[model samples]
Structures are given as structure tokens and as C-alpha cells.
Target: MAGGKLTARSAATTKPGTHGDGAGLYLVVSPSGGRKWVYRFTWQGKIRMMGLGSADVVSLAEARGLRDEARRLLASGSNPIEARREQERAEAGKPTFGAMADAFIDNKGAEWRNAKHRAQWTMTLREYCGAIRSRPVDEIDTEAVLSVLQPLWLEKPETASRLRGRIEAVLDAARARGHIPRNEANPARWRGHLDKLLPKRQKLTRGHHAAMPYAEVPGFVASLRERDALAAMALEFCILTATRTGEVLGARWSEIDMAGKVWTVPAERTKPGRPHRIPLAGRAMSILEKLAEGKTAEFVFPGQRAGKPLSNMAMEMVLRRMKIEGVTVHGFRSAFRDWAGNETRFPREVAEAALSHVIGDKAEQAYRRGDALEKRRALMDAWASYCEPPASNVIKMRKSGGGSAV
Candidate 1:
């Protein structure tokens, strides 16, 4: 205790003891000689000490004011310590846009089957939206979104479109978490809102993949057979099975069931993030047999590297070497789809399932769970037959208008 009743000058001079100002407010002095102001109070049979300020800095009058406020809070049944902590916690919960985006990616990345997909999510947002990363998520407005997207909207239409979708997803997630107040409309939503702000993305005259006309696929497959490279065999397998380039090149011997006559593409290797069962046709199985004669690696089509899959460009390079111009390896799937729609009696969903495409909306997909493997086997067999028509079935110089073949 201070020796006597203290004035401001006396409190400042008080050494190494707790000095009172006729109330719970006191000046605490340590033996090592530091001064601080504190308020002492009682609530519910407990004595609690609350720090006010250093006595050297806090005048006597200021300490009294703080002491009175603490008393008022105690009388009203609110603990000042708990109230401060709750306020601190609420502040801590508020995250800036960049921090929340990173958190969202980490949280959602696990569900994404591909590691590349997770990288793309972070890479796109960081590259495009660095400007608003430090801003509070609640303050990210339509103008901020437009500023990031407009530059790339026309310049890089596909990437910009995907970025807009990702941003919308992140914003919706933030809103759901109460990190941001819910707006009437999302700034990044495209349908009726952003469509007005930005110019429409130009529609392609041709499909995105440079597809050869379905009618020419048989002739093309015949030409592909002339080449004897491993890429040629891989491309033919891709065409016969109607599978993606990645799935065909990344194929492992273990994933193929020669007995069941099926190739199971795992979820990580597929676009739809689900395991797909491809009903192997005779031609597809034949190609696998040729490769299996003296297999050297885990991959069905191994690259120059010992155990790795073929390079992404290997099939495209094979087409280039064959002098096939203006076509992509991926375009074969489109050709298969077109032929299935136009020339075949197969149902559209069966064709879609053959290509491992997610048909229709979420509700439609939920109801149509079956992959229709048996029906797809028929469609694939027919497709294989069409790609390599038997010589006996090839009709030359058909007469027109009720005349027999010449």
C-alpha cells in the first residue's frame, strides 16, 4: 500500500506497491520499478482484477473514470474481461479476401480428384485477382470483379470464363459462412447480371476440338493403321474405345480386365471425377494384345522415360507425321459422338455414358445412376465395325434412284 492518500504527483512518485485512489482503481508498482493502473472488482463471489493503464501515463482522473465504468459493467452483470475476449474473437473471424480464398481452396481441394485441378484453382485466382486479395471479403464489389475479369474476358475467353465461375463459387461460400453479408446477387454471377456488364464471349464457328467429319473417320482410321509406331496403336485404342487421350496414355495394365473385356478408368484419370467402365471392343482388345506381347513398363503406352506415360503431344505428333492436317487427337471423341447421334440406333444417354460424359443437370444425373455397360458394349461394337468396315460390305459405285449397285 502507498503510505498516504495519493495525488497525481504522489501516485507518480509511489514506489513498488499498490496505491489506491479511494476506489477499486489502483496503481501497481513492481519491485523492479514499473507503474501501471488497474481496476479491482467483485462479481458473483469472485474477485477479478482488470488492467487499466500505467500510472505513469494514466492521470489519476482517467483511472477513476475507467474504475467507474468497470463498476457499472459489474452492476449490469457483464464481465468486462469476457466481453473484451468475445469482441476479440469476432474480429479474428473476419478474414481478408485473399486469406479466405486460400482457406477455401485448402478446404475444397481434397474433394477434387486431380492435383492439377487444385493448382489451377490457386494459380488462376492469384494471377488474375491479386488486386483485391488484401481487401475484406465483404468489401469485394461488382466493380472489383469486373476489373479482374474484363481484361481477360475477350483476350482469354476460356480462362476468364472459368475464373468468373470460381470467383462466384468462392463468394457464395463466403456468404454462406457469414464472412460476407449476403447480397441480392453475386457480383460474379453471369446469367442476367454480369452478362450486362461484360461483352458476350464469341461463339466458335467450329467446335473447340478440331474434329474431322464423322464420315471421314473410317478412312482416317485406315490411314492410322498404316503407321507402326506405339503412338499409332495408342491413338487407335483411343478411337476404338472412345476414351480421352489422357485416359488412353495413362492406362496401366492393372486397370484393364482382359477376362471381363472392360477397361476401368479411375476417377483421378477421368474428367467427371468418377470411375468409368469402358466396354472394350474387339479392335481395342486386339491393340492391347499386341502391346502386351513384351510389355516393359507399368503404363500400357510408356514414353521414352522408363515408367512414365506417353507425352501429351505424342498422338498429335503421330498425326502430324501421318500428314493429317487440321485435326486433334481429342477430336475423335467428338466424331464418335456425332456418328452416334446421326447414324446409330443407340440411345443418346448410352452414347453419353460410353464417352463418360455427365449427361444433363444434377437432378437428372442423380436419377440416371446406371452406366448402361451392356448397351454401351453394343454401341462400341457397332462403332468399331463402322471404323473398320469389312471389305465384303464396302459397296462401290452405287446407282442412284431405284437402281442397283454397279
Candidate 2:
């Protein structure tokens, strides 16, 4: 076989036959009238063959160019097929963590139960794990991972912990697919390295709820009541329903069923990635009704821009305006949970369900779907009554065992 250029026009003129060019290259003409370029070569002292492509697809000039390149690789003691694969891998190595993360998110975002979860995954990777986002996955190391977490390890331990774990998971996935090496110790694992460096987080304090006292809740609610606007209404609704900030901010009017007197938060909005039914208490309904009165926007709390939800910081600003310090908007859910557990007679499961929290064993949570909206309604109604101005007859219980009824 000899190597040379073969044009479509020349290929058409050739008779139906197989002929060699010089080296190991050949032009094969089929009976049905198809033309192709084939390369016959010796690799590792063994006969090898490869197709350059069709004369139409790979021009005669392109085929010769590939053959020349393959010959050069062969001279360098490399198998042409393996060399070609290596070249392909080198081209693919350009994808950075940020790029791969985007691709992964695009394919997997739909599988997430809610928009918040999807957003959190991307946001944390982009904002917190800055080193890994754009750097190649294979290049990520313990030091690189520590750069992202070390600064916040003590101050924002929980967030830092989650960011570390997520980064480890991303890298582990890349490693599993042979994009990187395996058995890399997770830089985020606290049990060994991080724990040795940082102060130990107390076990008793691990799950301690950071919430404002109930005694201060009325003052906070009263302060919020003075504000009049969609943001205010949304915040009030959040407080009444004991929902998260994202849930309240992202809520749409369509989710509220006025006829059914219920607000059904879809799985995408709920924290547990499941749908939650909230029985609209009289107060919560009133808040919604007032906001819906002559309102044309689709969002429960419409922003200044058309078709957009209210800013995420709207409720946080409300808390700040009330001069409440050291309390996050999210901590309000904790406050509600505290009130429900200590101040009300509602069952633990009912309170947990009202918060859209997954409780008990994983199997138990998997089996439980309903949010016990009716029971929650009663609890919310009582909560609303407590938050409202105290009635004249409502008595204050004494420190002693017995006290006069209201």
C-alpha cells in the first residue's frame, strides 16, 4: 500500500477495485460504488489496520495529513490508536470544575426536589469553593480544599462543613469516572485532621436551636405588624406558617387555594424536597386575602420588577428594622418550633410536619407523606391568638404549681 491524496473527483473516475498507494494506505472501491481510506500498519511487531474515514467525509488531503501524523507517532514508539486516544483525553482535560459543575447541574438539577436545593448546590460551589470551581478536578488537593474551608472553619463551621463535603463528593465522582485518582482523603473530614486543628464542637451543643425567646416574639411580631406592604405581608405569612425564608420569598399566589382554604407548598419549595400542605389559619388567610386584594402579580410577594419574586433580604431587613440583633431570618423557624414544643400542646410530629421537617427514622419519613394540615391549623390558630394583643381575662401563670385561669 502507498500513501497519497485521493479527491472525490479522482475517486469517482477509479474502477471498482482495491489498490495500494505506497506505504500501507489503500483506496477501496466497493461494487455498490462507495470509496474509503484504510491504513494498514505494524504496531508492536503485529499487523494492525484502521479506517481514516470515507473519501467524502475525510478529504484526500485530510486523510494524508492524518496518516502522516500517525506515522510520526509510530516513530516515537507509541501505538497510533493509543496515541489518538491520549490526544482525545488531553483535549477533554480542559474542562474545569466550574464547567463540569455546570454540566452536572444541568443534567441533575431536575432530579432535585426543589429550586432551593439546586441553587444551594451551585451557589455553594461557586461562592465558597472558589479554588475548585474553575481549577481542573485532577489538580484539586488537600491544600486547595483547605483554602476554601479554613477561613470559615471556626466562624461558619456548619456552612464550611457542608461546603467541604460537597466539594469532596464532586471530586470523588470525578475520580470514580477515572477523571482523577482514587482514595483521596476528604479534606473536609472533621473527625481527624480538621478536628485536630480546630476546637472540638461539643456534642450537647451540636443541635442546640438558635432562636429568639418566645417572650420576645410578640415584640418582634408587633414591630412587623406596623409595616404595610407585600414584603411585610410575606414576612407575616412566613411567621404564621413557620416556613423558611426561601419558601416564603419564592411563594406564588397560585399555590394558595382560597376555595380549599389551604396553601400547598410544592416539593420544590419545601426544605425536605416534598410537598407540604399548610392549613391557612384565620390570621394567615387574612394576610393572604389582604395581599391578594386587587393585586395582579403572580408572586405572593412581587418585587419591583415585573414577574419576579421579592428580594431574599426583604424579611431580614424587617428583622433589622425591628432592632433584633443576632437572629437570622431562618432562625424564625427555630423560634416557631420552640413555641410549638414548649408553649403549645401540639404533638412533636405535628410541629415537625408543619415545619416540613423530615423526622424519625428514614423509613418512617419515607412512609409519612401528609403534613397534618388540619391539626397544624389548630396549632397555628392558637399561635396567632398568642401573638395577638393579650385579652383582659387571659391570666399569667404563677411560678408555683397552681394559678388562676384566665
Q: What is the C-alpha RMSD of each candidate to the true structure, in Å?
A: 21.9, 19.3
TM-score of each: 0.50, 0.51
Candidate 2, residues 1-406, lDDT tens digits: the string is 1345554477657877886664677778898889888778885347888788887688766777778888876665456775564456568775566666667678778998877788677756654554455466677777777777765455456766777777766766676667775666655566777677656656212433345665566656665666776677787788788887667777788898997888887764554556778887888888888877746556777665434466656776776665666665556677777788778888999888778777899798678766677888888888877666443344332221111111
Task: Count the clashes in each prediction.
Answer: 1, 8
Q: Which ranges in model 1 have alpha carbons more than 4 Å from their true place?
A: 1-207, 389-406
Stretches of candidate 2 above 4 Å error? Answer: 1-106, 109-209, 391-406
Q: For candidate 1, list the clashing residue pairs, or say none.
A: 37-53
**For candidate 1, lDDT tens digit of each residue in 1-406?**
2332568788877778887776677788999889998888764346888898877678778878877877766665466665554455458776667777888898999999777587668766654565666567777889999887875565356778998999998888899998877655788899999988887777523225666777777777776776788899999999999887767877999999999999998765676658899999999999999889857566898765333467656787887776676667777888889889889889888998998877899898889888999999999999999998435444332111111110
In model 1, what is the error at residue 95, expressed in angstroms?
32
User: Candidate 2 — worst ten consecutive residues by lDDT sum?
Assistant: 397-406
Go through the candidates in order and give each one's C-alpha lDDT: 0.76, 0.68
